[model samples]
Each structure stands twice: as C-alpha cells, then as structure tokens.
Target: MADTQTYKFNVGMTCGGCSNAVNRALTKLDGVSKVDISLETQIVEVQATIPQADVLEAIKKTGKPVTPL
Candidate 1:
C-alpha cells in the first residue's frame, strides 16, 4: 500500500459553506482517507495516499484560493 501523507493547506474560507465545499471536494478524491477543516483558521488538513498536487487541485476546484502548507 502507498504511504499516507498529511497535507495542510491555507484555504480562504469565510463561512461554513466554503469549508463544507472544500471538505466535499477533498473527500471525493479516491486517495483521500480523511479531511479536517477549520473555518475559523481557514485551514484544511488532509490525510491521503495521493500526491500533494492532487489534493491541492481538489481544494482549488471549490473556487477558493489555496496555499499548500
């Protein structure tokens, strides 16, 4: 099995809807195993076997600016 990696991202989420959208987009990815989002902090943490680029792209699809941390 592929090693799981933890990726943190700075997502510009102003509301619950924004965070939820990011969460849904990330969770739908095949290699993503878990997702944790904090709207207050505007951060999203993802546990996945996929590449970090893939995770970043997933979050981007939500139409929010994402900065990988």
Candidate 2:
C-alpha cells in the first residue's frame, strides 16, 4: 500500500489551470499514486510510496515550493 503524504507549496498558483499544471508535472513521476492540489492554500496531498526527497524534487520540477506537513 502506498503512504499518503501532505505537502504545502509556496508557488503562486492562482487558478485551477495552474493547479492542473503542477498536477500534470508531478503525476508523471514514478511512485506517485495520486495528487490533490488546492490553489487556495497552495497545498498538495499525495498518495505514494516514494521518498519525500524524490517527491520534493518532483514538485520542484514543476517549479513549485513543496514542504512536508
């Protein structure tokens, strides 16, 4: 089973389209099972077994700020 991890991103994503941009970028990474992003709080909730380090890197690849919660 994959573990669910919640993260907060500091990127300035102001719309649903921006959310989709980040989602598309992160979802392509290996071990990422799911992603739920909130533009209001700039948070991303992910379900995956990948290491937090890899996750962070993947999020950065999307040009977003990601912090563990």
Candidate 3:
C-alpha cells in the first residue's frame, strides 16, 4: 500500500474544539498518518494509507457534515 495519500474534506469545524474533535477522530482511524484542519477554510486535510471510505466514515462519526475536498 501507499505510504501516504491526501484526502480533502469539507468539514464545518467552527472552533478549536471542533478542529480537535475532527482531528482526534481521524487520527484514531486504521491508517491515518496525520490530519491538518483549517477552520478558516472549513477543510480537513488528511494523510493516510486507509481508504477514503473509512476516512469518510470516521468524519461522519464526528456528527458533522463532511465532503471530499
């Protein structure tokens, strides 16, 4: 499998807590390497070896709307 893959998300995280929430959720997934959240941009950039579907599920589990970036 690839070492790193980028997955962009349209996460509506309004505060630092929201960002952290999304970050932690993504970090807990199977093959995530790192997560970069931009509150200003409303985007959660992810680096992972896991599938996008899994990542999406994790994001959805946060109880916030997310879309591929």
* Winning candidate number (lDDT): 1
Which 10 residues in a row give candidate 1 its minimum summed lDDT?
A: 19-28
lDDT of 3 by residue, 1-69 (tens): 676889999997888898889988988888898888889999888999988999999999999888887
Report the C-alpha lDDT of model 2 over 14-67, residue by residue, as the tens digit: 788778878887799788778888788878877777787787777777665556
What TM-score do all the candidates reach, one by one?
0.97, 0.72, 0.90
- Candidate 2 vs. truth: CA RMSD? 2.4
RMSD of each: 0.5, 2.4, 1.2
The best-first sequence of candidates by TM-score reads 1, 3, 2
lDDT of 1 by residue, 1-69 (tens): 999999999999998889989988988899999999988898899999999999998888889999999
Q: Candidate 1: where are CA atoms >4 Å away?
A: none
Off by over 4 Å in 3: 1-3
Q: Clash number for model 3?
A: 1
Locate the minimum summed-lDDT window of 10 residues in model 2: 3-12
Candidate 3: residue 34 lDDT (0-100): 84
Which candidate, 2 or 3, would have the higher lDDT against the true structure?
3
Arrange candidates by lDDT, descending: 1, 3, 2
lDDT of 2 at 63: 66
